[model samples]
Target: MGIKRTVLIDEPFPDLFCGLCQGEFWEIDFIPVLVPHFVFLLLLLLEILDDPVQVRCPEDHMFCSSCIGNYLQQSRTCPHCLTDLDPSLFQPSKFVQRQIGRLRVRCPYHEAGCTWQGILSDSHPNEDR
Candidate 1:
């Protein structure tokens, strides 16, 4: 609960994108403004990452747990560096998870007329979405 600020979607934040799907690592509360068409497409593809995991590489690349798990089953190598990977060594990225949890996002039903927007982790299933 620091400064409650909103981020414009015009600038790209590389760390916010998932390595596997190239989609946003978390949904964001978008401001109503005139943005480029591509930005809208990117927003449309936004998804709340499930079980974010960090790869055991120097770069510490991250991917959704399911994505990395499935990829490892096919090839036991880091997707970014092609280095040998040990599935057992993979661990949930608690730091990244916390960061994502702090993000502000509109309700999943925002497009369906829900105006609720707040901290992602604070959103509850019983919300009036």
Candidate 2:
């Protein structure tokens, strides 16, 4: 019952990763191979922001919504700056979401022979394979 959404892309921007969990806001599958005369690097699958949120701290640290929420429940402070945290002050990161949506991704079942691939924004959770 977890978020199984996934996508394939080349190296992603470093900032897209959450500062708290050190996770890419999504599950990811990275594949790289080297043959005798060729280098084969398969597209990597990454989970695109599962409810991404941004801290109001001056550093503007970002984290997966669930990760921060759980952390704040125990200690009310920014993970990066230790600034006092107010869960109500957390804001959704539309900019980050848009950026992540721009990434191209293959079906989570690609390795199992599913050939579907497209822009993240255009993908539907209930897509018919």
Candidate 3:
């Protein structure tokens, strides 16, 4: 067999929040972190298979709960990757918890020279509460 990509789907999506700065996504903005769309799709599939269905933002840049709830009631597919969303497949689980919680990861833009890491929950700080 050829060499395999070992990128873990189980790992949490990187958070963009900064607890130290108490900043939001744009506020703590660094360089652009480019994730190939295909890779993002792969990760989303692995995540949704585990618990309640997840949705993407209108810009197709991030995942959101309320956005998904609203979108699913009208459409059965993700606005971003067009992944089919089956509400029947949604089963709420206490296991449903933020993967990174309040931690940070190398900025997706680390491929360049921007050294920044923050909370993933910071993606859409003004959405829920």
Write one digit per residue (lDDT tens) for candidate 3, span 1-129: 100111221233332111112112221223445443222211322222122233333432333344456555777776655676655554332233343333233444444554544454344322222
Residue 79 C-alpha lDDT in model 1: 78
Q: Among these predicted structures, which one has the highest lDDT? A: 2
The C-alpha TM-scores of every prediction are 0.64, 0.66, 0.33
The local lDDT score (0 to 100) that residue 51 gets in candidate 3 is 22
**What are the clashing pairs of model 1?**
none
lDDT of 1 by residue, 1-129 (tens): 111122323333346445555433443445565433321111223443446777787767677787677777789888778988877778787766666666545556655665666665674553652
What digit string (tens of lDDT, one per residue) describes model 2 on residues 14-101?
5665545533345465444221221111122223345678878887777778767878778888877799977788898877667666
**The best candidate in terms of TM-score:** 2
Worst 10 contiguous positions by lDDT, candidate 2: 35-44
Q: Which lDDT value does model 3 have at 117?
A: 46
